[model samples]
Target: MANNDIEVGSRGSLPRKDYFEPLPAPMIDMEELAKWSFYRAIIAEFVATLLFLYVVVLTVIGNKTQTDPIIGGNLCGGVGTLGIAWVFGGMIFVLVYCTAGISGGHINPAVTFGMFLGRKISLIRALLYIIAQCLGALCGCALVKSLQRDRYNHYGGAANQLVDGYSKGTGLAVEIVGTFVLLYTVFSATDPKRNARDSYVPVLAPLPIGFTVFMVHLATIPITGTGINPARSFGAAVIINDKEIWKDHWIFWVGPLIGATIATMYYQYVLRASAVKAIGSFRSTPPTRH
Candidate 1:
């Protein structure tokens, strides 16, 4: 009887459910996986960029142009400049949420190339990302062409070019300043140290990044239509097939890449070091666990 009691007690004391041990941190070396992971990320970036361009171009074409008045004499829909900015900004908001984890949400070839130049990304990965971005842009342009069809002749698909009376110098300046602001925001928002607080990481980054694009459009729409992202400009320009736009496209790519490179350097050498010091201070203090 005593033996039976012991067994029963032991059985009762045992946990009702098995305790689960956490899976070990993934053993894949980052360097070893870098090549393949980057390619996957590039593909994700491409898809995301394509979605962004397609949505924005379609909206612009459908809303902005004056199609023949309906039988009842009314415009179907019209999204003005501000509305267009919102649409473009909103698309970025969605894409970043979807793709940030996969590719750091760099849907711009200039950004990818800049990071590569800064040594933040490997050369193999950068090439793959550029290829993906270009292909994605082409796909997006093709979609816009198909959707608009006959209307395509009237629609420029939101292609970037200097407005009449705006000089090449003015366009270059706008692109440089706009891109610098954007890259700076990207660096601040994504730096793990700056966004170390649990609440900020996933939520805040997208907002600022999206807002930056909106603000850029607001400021530069008249001057150059704000080609802060070269992939965006390329996508639209390809659809428009404007040789003049293509000739000036170098400014978009070069300016953004320069700005991103500068921002990355500042973040790495100055901001990151300060962040490390700040985090270190917290770590040195003993935690009083309850």
Candidate 2:
């Protein structure tokens, strides 16, 4: 077959070329330490994660607590689940858009892990990004506590744990699936193949990614408090410091990392990445003897 996309009745179209050109990120790029841009990227991750956790947790606390005293019940309250989902989604859109050029807009440790697993970022960068994100999350949640100490602890502001009737297994599974959805969207939205093929995808990638986050949150909020981002969960837990909430704390991190791994595998292998091409291709003519 020639070097072009070929059509199969059942398979749609298959491109002979991988069409992905970038070399894998180096495991240890010492030279990156000298680049101010590298540190800037780390800072961007920190600030973005900080803003993300701060805004979202504050919204959660306010929404849950801001009930109508006149009504004298929990019937009509704050923005509700729908609004909370929107905040998570919308904030992600804004944050990703603002810092994409600088830090690739990885506000979540799960996202950073997925990028590193996919070979899109260096190991060093990934480590630093995770550290920055976690620190930022800690600070963001601390800020909320500082302003509303009683409400923060009293209302269970942002701590992630299984609600009543949910098992540890259920919590873990939901986190895995939630993070899988998020990382899958991130990979698809940022794929170079898609960008080169679809003229508009690169410019508006954040929209779909943000929408996915919103959708995931709406699905998982009542069950596990939607802990797709480990950093977000960590920050909230640390600031809230409820002993009961720590029982299932590992679910948030382990689940999301597992989800990220699954998504990476699905994108890189199941969806026909370089690994598929490694099987070799047909030749128009057989090789001649040397």
Candidate 3:
């Protein structure tokens, strides 16, 4: 999800001048279905997503358990909101690092959706990847439930909920903006052009990606519980199965999806200046024969 997009596209004028090669992945690359690497990538996505959801959900439940004196027996307060943010962010950093080589480390559906819109991945691959991620997330939450059904049920399954004061729209807004921050960071971090031009600059892709998630959660956790990743939201919702959780469920999916779309367009047209490149290509003069 961070560092492995193919680079073969229009290198207008001098290859160095183009800055990026935008190869639109085929819409239906059936050939990928036959490859072992494709299946390998799918499995990687599954396990990575599973671990991501598993750890984050567990941390959330644990924090709630400790914070409530009635339940925790005055456990000296739980790992507060700050700690929860760290766990989410830290786990992302660890998981992305671990699986990036295998499946580009796409543990989140929003990241995969953004990549799809940018044509970085084939439609078939993107679809399957999303399915695998969602299932993995479900299993991860289910794991937490299986281990401590009472505790899990006690903590409301850690499903994202719109806080008491916020309106549904406000909750939706946070999800969109939070996801935008995350997806935008993903695009900027994995930019092939930046990587090529600034080869000497030492930067780890996973670091920023993880930090973006952490920061977004910090700001929006109180709003919509920060559903920047659709798969993350979906898993928790499915496992919890409480009627109340379903009330704002649409916000989780819609907000992240819309945010991803915006980020994809913003990166391609505004930040990357794809529009400028197109106009330049149309206007450039052909060299006359010597």
- Give stretches of model 1 more than 4 Å off: 1-36, 66-77, 273-290
lDDT of 3 by residue, 62-152 (tens): 8888778785455557787888899899999889888877788878888899998888899999999999999999999999999999999
Candidate 2 regions off by >4 Å?
1-20, 68-74, 279-290
TM-score for candidate 2, please give it: 0.88
Q: Please give each candidate's TM-score.
A: 0.76, 0.88, 0.89
What residue pairs clash in candidate 2, if any at all?
Answer: none
Cα lDDT tens digits, model 2, 1-290, are 12342322224553232343456678888898999999999999999999998899999888877773643636466899999999999999999989988999989999999999888898999999999999999999999999999878878867998899989999899999999999999998988767546557867988989999999999999999899999999989988888988888999999999999999989877884557545654435533321
Which ranges of candidate 3 are over 4 A from the true structure?
A: 1-20, 200-203, 279-290
Instruction: State in Å the error of residue 116, model 2.
Output: 0.8
lDDT of 1 by residue, 1-290 (tens): 11111111134453222212122123233573546665679779889989988888787776656443642323544766777788878888788878888887888876676566545566666777778887888789789888766666565667888888988888888888888788778777775433323335667788888888888888888788788888888878877887777888887787777777777667655765534543453244433322
Better of 1 and 3 by lDDT: 3
In candidate 2, position 149 carries an lDDT of 91
List the RMSD of every prediction in angstroms: 11.1, 4.9, 5.0
lDDT of each: 0.71, 0.86, 0.84
Arranged by TM-score with the best first, the candidates are 3, 2, 1
